[model samples]
Target: MNLFKYWKKDVPASLVVFFVALPLCLGIALASGAPLFSGVIAGIIGGVVVGLISKSNIGVSGPAAGLTAIVLTAITDLGGYEIFLVSVVMAGILQIIMGLLKAGVIGYYFPSSVIKGMLCAIGIIILLKQIPLVLGLSGEMESDRITFINFHEKISIGVIIVSVVSLLVLLLWDEVLAKRSNLFKLVPGPLIAVAIGIIIYLTMGQSGDLALNQSQLVNVPIPEDFNSFISNFTFPNFSALNNPAVYLTALTIAVVASLETLLSVEATDKLDPMKRQTPTSFELIAQGIGNTLSGLIGGLPLTQVIVRSSANVMSGGLSKLSTVLHGLLLLLSVIIIPKLLNLIPLAVLASVLLIIGYKLANPKRFVEMYKLGKEQFIPFIVTVVAIVIFDLLVGIIAGLIVGVIVLLLKSYTNSHSMLIKEFEGKKNLYHMNLAEEVTFVNRGSIVKELDALPQGAFLELDFRKTKILDYDILEYLDEFKVKAKNNNIQIKIISERGIVDDPHSFREFFGHKVFKMGH
Candidate 1:
């Protein structure tokens, strides 16, 4: 817990995370159909508040892109952005409740396939959303509808040139320059890319036709004075607190934001070089507080974003201080140098996002998932496709459903393996070896296997390897035991503890251990 032990590494890491997070905060707020400044506010709160509260060392919290669709719809449904802030507050309260209830355990239920799919889908969405910006095909920052069909019509040659050069510089810095020097390693590629992009913009501005307009660049509002700057911060309209629609929006935002946060927590922990474990419930509480504060002021809902967390880890952030420092930088930049931030072109930010998107949805990931077999690949692909076609929540639900189906299918197939042994001068032996875990999904298969046993045969039920047997399956076994007795089939159950001879009650046999089974 020595925050300054790694300040040398943490300072540079925080700067890297700040550069990566700034554009994202703005972009996500734009996508959410909220005030652009609100995103920056959320970024600041997420870094300073959540980072200070959360136990995670490397996980960085901020305005999440996953909730953009929900936020956009909620704003429209709630009638105004101010009213939607009420929901954001409610969501934060709900998240705090969830944390206290230890509902963060739900994070463990998500299958790896579904998680992978969610990441891939988000990656694809990022790429799609940035295409218009990168190509300067559209002036609108938040539109996710941009596709190749209309891309050709809105292409700006100057913007395209800037984007290409920025991307190349990023690639060169990341792939080549970083390897050659510690200075390059400390200076993130995105920062370098952004600098190059601004230089290109300034250079190209000398040419009348090649000059980029205000719409094509970052549109951070520059206040004429201190009072005007302070006026940009918005407060929630508490008058909408009684509205049922407001509550509904709150529930949706809380659930979606919590889910995204949990997923990012899991992903970030996996990426940690120290393999540190982040307390899930504590993380939720931190997020809850962060979101509540964000809504009270003028900021979007926040979550532990994978993109930011990954950048933090890659940048060698060793503690939450890096996250807090990044927030401080964001706050200072907006207050002291908003005009300089406004100079950044949208195309440059788009290029940086495109790189992140590529990393997330890399073709190699698809190939690797495919290699994991059909069970993993199907859900992963389904989630990716569903997210692309519908939205983040819908795609994840679709993927989870598919993942559950695959799990059931696996349980059905691997429930038990039957082996018939022919012993000299002995009754025919029917051996059934149960799997490590047997659930209700394996009931039908187990029933069929027991029914297929021949009359006067010796049934050897091996449960030594079985860690769990569902009550439904055990109940079915109890009935099957009676039927086997009538058919003159002798039953011998072998468990990890010992052998069970003609057990009257399977429930009694399982005893106190059954309570801990699913848990």
Candidate 2:
């Protein structure tokens, strides 16, 4: 990393990613029923700490929305926020152990179809999640702050206008303006949208119902002094280490966090224009360190988030510097200019996410997948549907199961290929060729082909390329001999061993114990 070479690109990309990350951190914390500030802490640690150590060039880490349910349940069951932090710390330790054990190989097993499906599913989720926000369904009035925004009575007219126009800005930048000049390329669309949003808030938000509500703006906690800032973070209950529930929750968080991280790493690699592969094991250690630090300081457990990574890629972030810079920006924003940051509208950020979402789930990608045929398309579509209906982990497992079944079906059909020859002066002759390996699972396929043979036909069974022949297949061949004789069919068998006069001679030719051996 010239580290210095990409400052021009990374700076703008970092700003865009920072804005994208802020709401996510807050929202995920809210969903988890934890202090909203904890999400922000995790975001900062994930970016600055994990980003510093991770081998992945473009991946960005944060508190994942996927882990919200687990966090919520664990927090409730474990007694309180302080108790939950113990589990988070223990989870980080387990993750580090996994990394040392080289368990990262599992990341490679996911097929491209499933990976693409996950990316698209996440994109769709982003688009859907932002709809209400984009419409400015804010909650807080003048007096107090609200945890979650609701889509109740009325939508904001100002919010709608700002979202629409900001979305248009994003669209025009990507599809048209960015290509025309270096200036447009230098200024990220999200940053421009934010600036415009701030202007709108200042100009139209002095005093009226049309003003953006407190919930509609960024709401980071502002501390007056160092001691007060330190007081904002909650510490873990060390005594909870004795509880078995703590270990169980730790196991859950470690497993979920590791898996989500690997998935995001794979997806990020696919999205990278440079196509850099992250060292999965090393990445795990990085995440473990970040989580441990986050837990110690009373923050939510974190994972590599695909949405932020995709935003980084979309914004032209060229190095890990972008990841680090985004983290630094997050830290500075809450302390340095919390008031100024609050002026930024959530609707503009929603518009930014909506554009990134559309690009990920573009219709053209679906057409491309379909063109690859059903083997690829089926799992791709299934993963998308599963993720949309359920959650990330379930969707991936569903897709993996479907992918394997499709593979098995292909293997079954591909057991053998046949060629038929019939001439005016000769008998109808059929040649059946076997693949390199045949197993019991191919029984139905072979039976179907054998039963299709016509009466009085001369049949040639070729197994020269075969390396392994299962005993069940030999038994099936012996059974076929009886039918061949009944139909008055002449049969010849060929293999590396030699051509056999009797198909049933296989019993004597290949000993029972030798059936499993490869030629």
Candidate 3:
């Protein structure tokens, strides 16, 4: 395909995504206990491999922050990173099997509200998790930062100064410069912030405020030789297949990674200018392959990351080729300039992520959901708070449980309110009670009760107590009107207004119908 035509837009997008992906790859690796380069390897593979395979218009894959906890736990529980790697590989294989079986539709089982909650939660989690990194503190000290500022002896005022200042600057730039200047349209705000951060870091290094966080530096292990590079790759400890820990780890990875990927794919599609739907089944298969490959090679587990994907869309990617190119850049960077990468400060990278994190969890998003009404807000807020308190996956599960409960509750309440009673001394007549308001959610039950009337039967729909009726139910009634006419069944709608005849879908569905409440 003619790919270069879109390169003008895609290249800038890839660069922005590259910067965004850089820290996450490293931070997630640091969080996961894998060598930082392994994360980079995963990013490359995710972009080049999964990006190429994905049917999504704009999704970027890489080492997922969501997997950090699982990876850390797996490493210790399974006895080593190598053994955990085995589970990851096997997890990939499982994903492949799931894809082949069309299990991707499992994503559809989740309500849209729950999925939105999941994303908002991740955004909050990203912001919280990065605070320590932004301040140059050790995420190594506490994987679970339940309470704010545990200060587990790793906090430094100097680091905090740099982090807070960097975060503020980044935030200010995103708000002021990004909106105020046309410069940001041509050159990204993050790029500008990074350049400024590097200068500030250099200035601080010269003055010595940067020393406390020096240990938090990005380390891309220098490969002494091709053999050494090859040797660095860790293979799965397939022997651990029988181990309960390994199976659990694999299942955890498959489930969490799949959810994140599916939700991200959905969110990314919403952001797409073209609005072409991503094939969830195909996405699972692609992610399965990417994760499998990552696990096989000494790399972190992968997911379709939205931060990078948003950058891709904002930058103007025409196809998946832009994603592939970004991966290649990541690969080339590590191979050619591993040492130069070390020069980039963690604070600078954190600055980039802070901007992205804020964008994802923006306060405005909450307002938008609230505007949609309670049907959307409860799940959204639950997802956000849960992710902030616990982590990504747990928060999503919590939101989903809440969402499903609310759904069932609504169903039960509506079902209970429905009125269907047989008319006394009238073998063919049946009386139905109507609620104040009816919508599509209760359409099925209403239809089922109405359709059960015997052929040649007379039916009376009593809306005397009903204030409002849903259009969907009316549509169903119109269909049944034809059925009643053919089967010699009489239909009567008795309402406070008057008695009404058949309503057609196109012509008179919205007009007033006759109904009489009192005899």
Candidate 4:
């Protein structure tokens, strides 16, 4: 494919993603309790470095909200931001090792139910986190700390009015204008909302009551000179490398960041219109390099983020160049016109995030999961609730545990089928057909079926269609064979290999060589 053939499309798409990414970078950093510039630095590296290295045509990378809790805690536990950067570097090295080991297959083990739950949970989190900002509340206060009484007291009328208008403009652009005109398609709703916010900031400035204070607006730090801008970049404290806690923190970050990146890759590929597949292992390596560079330069750990990736896809991005362009835009904006960017209201950015969150946590998704059955819906709901109550890692683990139980229950309940046949001038014949997958969970069901067999009967145990027969099931069958002989029941085992007349060879008949050898 000619990568530049879609430049016309990709350029506009990049612009849209840039607008979507800007506030997120700042918000995540604020949430992470790190320097705001670190987030932007990660965004730049994720875009230019990972984007160029990654094979994913549509996937976008940046500072992940999923890592915010981890970073916040690590910074405190590690003693300082510089020390935490050391952990990030070590994490990058670990990610590179994992990639080289081809451990990306772990992504496939995550159930779809859990992944959907994760998405929904993140959506709920984004909504809850942005509510205060949307209502004009500022600072690094936690969402739980903002009570209705305090929220009402702190609400700024000007910010509220601007936010409402910005949200409405976003809806109009997406729901109406984009559908009506091609010009509107080139310009994204987020960009329009931001522009309207800036206009309102200027329009309301003349009236003291309507004007928004500095706290209500975007806080892009304005550097005094070239030296000041250069000074903002921080280097990791290498002395922390000897600390055992640093290694532990690094391992945690590596595992969590890798999982998040792989998850986002899966989500983005599903959203791709062309259905292009991403090389998961290669993507990990790219992310590893990006994180390593980011950590060295005092940036947040980066990952393939679904929110930004989905935005890129929805906005018509067709290649990695769009992602790269967005990074360049972020770099230039911070350096050249940060003051102008600061004019945009935080409320407007919060409105943009609210829309994205609503899309992710749409009620229809829950309805769809419910229609899929309890096997899917239960895990999905559990994941959402768990994430809302706890952190991302805890919520995912809870959902995964629930999903595994459902799988085991299904395996237990549907292990085998039994049939009885009668022939002329012959004793009754019983046939048992094992399910395609017979695990330890199905051992009890199989045993019950075996115990119900009648005496002086001819039995045919069929394993022709069975793919996996557990060791416990084989052992139970071995014991049953001895009892069958005492009951004067003739047993014949049919399998893919052949019929086995000897009971000791039953495990071999089903391809369990290790079990046969032990016997």
Better by TM-score, candidate 2 or 1: 2
Which candidate comes out best when scored by TM-score? 2
Q: List candidate 1 stretches off by more than 4 Å.
A: 139-154, 206-209, 424-428, 453-458, 463-471, 478-519
> What's the lDDT of the predicted structure labeled candidate 2?
0.87
Per-model TM values vs. the true structure = 0.86, 0.92, 0.73, 0.89
Q: Please list the C-alpha lDDT of all candidates, in the order they appear.
A: 0.84, 0.87, 0.72, 0.83
* Clashing pairs for predicted structure model 4, backbone only: none
* Regions of model 3 farther than 4 Å from truth: 136-186, 210-212, 237-249, 310-318, 413-519
The best candidate by lDDT is 2
Q: In model 3, state the lDDT of residue 271.
A: 69
Q: On a 0 to 1 TM-score scale, where does candidate 3 land against the true structure?
A: 0.73
For model 4, the stretches where C-alpha displacement exceeds 4 angstroms are: 1-3, 138-152, 206-208, 420-429, 454-458, 485-519
The alpha-carbon deviation from the true structure for residue 55 of candidate 4, after best TM-score superposition, in angstroms, is 1.6
* Cα TM-score of candidate 4: 0.89
Each model's total of backbone clashes = 0, 0, 7, 0
